[model samples]
Target: MSGPRMTVVFATRDRATLLPRVLDRFAELQSPPGGWSLVVVDNGSRDRTVEVLRSYTDRLPLTALSCPQPGKNRALNAALQHLQGDLAVFTDDDVLPEPDWLVRLRAAADSHPEADLFGGTVLPDWPQPKPDWLCERAVEFSVLYAQQRRPSGACGFADIFGPNMAVRSAIFAAGTRFAEHVGPDDTNPLYAMGSETELLRRLEGAGHRGWFEASACVRHIIRPEQMEERWILNRAFRYGVGEGRHYAGRRSVGLLVRRLVYGIAARGSALLPPSPRRLRIRYRDRWLAGVAAGRPAARASPPSG
Candidate 1:
């Protein structure tokens, strides 16, 4: 309660059953240097999320904001105006932070006063064992919110995931908000998933420094439905959609043709891998196909100004 004040923010929709546990986890977190509080944005949930949040009112230092709008970014942007700390830390409703999570983040912030962006490690907390096709590769597990594990170090802004990231209040004060159109939305079917990525990239492009705090760890829960092959593939397809959107500014007919050829070849080679590697290859191939599938029209339409 004596260092830098921090505000932890997250947005949730219709996850009432799982929210109490998250709040419980937040209760266990050590306060950062200047003291810390929670701000949760309820993004138009029809379920008992509001009720559950209200239940935690006295137990934790918390504020609940109602965002009638649907997008995750929309809720986050709304929460920004209500933040009461110098540091605004972002995480998802489903993450469990280590008890020392904020302590480590605060340490890094105090140690590196020049950095405006901070990223932390995210490890997957699966409800069940992972299947064989999805081998345990920390570097390749971002799909489940597992960020690359390395010693606490510096990294690109694009490497910052939404589940465990923080930014100085000054950055928001300078007028940066999460991209409205491309993030997770309860009502939107597209699910493009890159609002944080876009925001960090924008900040980095403008010369903001970032740091990665290895000790600031969070366990992202992987539910049973997410373990299913169909769901995983669908997530890959959405990732591909993000890829398409990312390239919208520079997409060309030639680039689209090249993507088509590469995708076809990748699919053809996918038919030949042995069983162990076959599923993985197929997953990648499908993701590539999705990229190609989304590229043509993306290239045809001019990017928005």
Candidate 2:
């Protein structure tokens, strides 16, 4: 039997210099039996992102869309109406998929008829002469880099991340859209994270089953700037904020006390030598602070399909 058609979706912003390599990799992808198409959404980019995308129109099966909105989730929600085929694959502009990426995902979908959601492995594409701190805490900081740790097989919603995941098209056909409140928003420096995780959690809550396709993998480019300690810690804080928003209703006195304790410990760790333990503590502390802040009160109205 032929495999299901796939629609690969991703939103990019101000990555003009890096997008060409990513698109070049996409051009080399081996099409699955059911074929595939790429949808690239330019999310309010102020750089040469538009020109870069247009240059790739002839090299790949690409359809470019523009969403002047700031949030990553809002840009993705806007692409829902253009989605076609049996599966909607999500990834980022900085990721490089293997030639057989879609083939493996399609095969996994064919093998697991019961699963509606599919997650692929995400490995890091580290910069050369990696920083010592990153080398030491690479495994521990996998979550921060969107790296997948789960073994291939049945998995939970938490196992699926934005950099590499897919879901049945029918899910969107039924009116399920990403929550626009969370995710990257250039307008807000403190915007909530977990754009994809929030949606996965909701799907699981509604009884959706997920699968892990170990063979289908992508390498998420870890830019040199991301190697900086400050950038990593900022990501940690945003992650905490995302988690806090995710579990907003479950907040309690105990959680508050824990956050207080973490704050003190994080400050104390700053005086110590640079070590994995100290970095871990600082990361956790920032995250806890974000959790305490919780979700933002003013949310943009969700886009309609």
Candidate 3:
């Protein structure tokens, strides 16, 4: 089969200040054989996000959409109707793709025609100096909502990071959509993440394959506010909660109780010292708490336009 057409999709809310810079970067990106357009869904931003998007209409192949509904997944599902590409590339509103990012993705797709999913690398672009404490756990955590950094290679797992992933349009045609309740909802702290996690896992179980292309890279901008420990801890808590949602079906009430018991023990251990062990213990406790509170499975729903 030939390389399919591509359309990059991303949803944003309330970040009017940063979306313009991202669009500037998109303007610099080189397209693949069939060319690609952009679909930016504004998830009810009270700010001038739509105006900012409209301003860029003459600068790029852009479509500005307004999704007054809540949630990132809802916005994404809503934007699906507007996409006119054989492959849907997903990224964040704050990301900067390399000039050849789409070219590399096309190359990978052309080489691996049998694969239906693709993941790429996401590097961090710190706007200012990164504090040591922040860099300490950076390798383990995305810290800035960038794709999780990993070694260069191909893999079978559907662990595609939301910041840089692509899927065949056919998958959506098969009636699959991102789990409505699993992703971040405009800073709603209670929302369990992993919108792509649940969807990709579903795709993988159906025998669809995925490939990781390291060269198709993008830079995720990290602002100063995210450098604080308080912010990082909150992110960690949400990540743990997402993990709990992933394991919900496999967990029995008795098993969950046991995990919480162990988590409590870990919390006690966390107080022993200020070493790595302490950090690990604290992380474990928060993750377990998320597991206890998060829903095991996503509720199914049709995509809304």
Candidate 4:
């Protein structure tokens, strides 16, 4: 907290190929005064990831932790214990950042020392000739927060991608640990049904600050697998589950009604005569997923190695 301004914490399952590019981006940061570090949290990878990580030997500040468990929070917790930064910058293995990411994040944190949480824009990385599907996906992702002039939950949606978010070191140092039981675990919320959003909410409750910035941008890799219809439906449903979990104690008739309305509205949107033929099916599947209230947390882990 006294010397260096920030540290980079990269968590991955089996992203050996993508690690270097991400590291290289950070290495290119412009005129950074503070000593920043990168932590690679291996969440149970069997591939040549460890070997590939070894390739970064010259990037001496790098540290690696092997978390055999496949859950995101489990691996993140393991890596978090090993970190000692005033700021912990978290980005997914699949995403690549602009060189100034750290500078902007550090500046954002310094500008608002009181806020315990920090969030930034996560624009999608569409293929050079962006596909129609990717365009729809972009709208879906952005509409969730395009209205947020500041950090608050009143927008009927509150979310942040783990791939492009940062949190104060004290959030971890101050014993504000993430939920080990859920989140990044079996399609679960890490902090007992709270997503990163819920964690920020807690930070807010505890009088921690959260701010939004345009400068901290990362292009998330919307992989081919994620483009599948079933995949997005699953994502939409899990979103409901996470949101439902976070607002557990406060659920009321009004809230339930609002959700019901959402369900109907989504169904109506899917029914729109002009909606894309391919995406409508996707929307239909999503509505069904929402109606089903999402499947129970999957015991299955992402294919590793």
Candidate 4, residues 105-125: lDDT per residue as tens digits?
Answer: 777777776565676667766
RMSD of each: 4.3, 4.6, 5.4, 5.8
TM-score of each: 0.88, 0.93, 0.86, 0.76
Worst 10 residues of 1 by lDDT: 296-305
lDDT tens digits, residue span 1-305, model 1: 38768999999999999998889999999877788989999999999999999999998899999998899999999989877767899999999999999999989988988898999888888898776666643115775455546678777886678899999998888788888877887665546657888899889999999999888999898889987655665666667667777775664566556556655655665567334355565556555545554554642221111
| lDDT (tens digit, per residue) of candidate 2 on 48-123 | 9999999999999999999998988889999989888989999999999999999999999889989999999898
Model 3 ranges with Cα > 4 A deviation: 1-4, 136-139, 150-153, 252-278, 295-305
- RMSD value for candidate 4: 5.8
Q: Count the backbone clashes (under 3 Å) in each candidate.
A: 3, 0, 0, 11
Candidate 3 — what's its lDDT? 0.76
User: What are the Cα lDDT values of the candidates?
Assistant: 0.78, 0.85, 0.76, 0.60
Question: Alpha-carbon error at 64 in model 3, in Å?
Answer: 0.9
lDDT per residue as tens, model 3, 182-285: 78786575567678878888889899898889888998888787765455545656665677778766745675676667667765764574445555555555
Of the pair 1 and 4, which is ahead by lDDT? 1
lDDT of 2: 0.85
Candidate number achieving the greatest TM-score relative to the actual structure: 2
Task: Give every collision pair in model 2.
Answer: none
Model 1 C-alpha RMSD vs. true structure (Å) is 4.3
Give the candidate order by descending lDDT: 2, 1, 3, 4
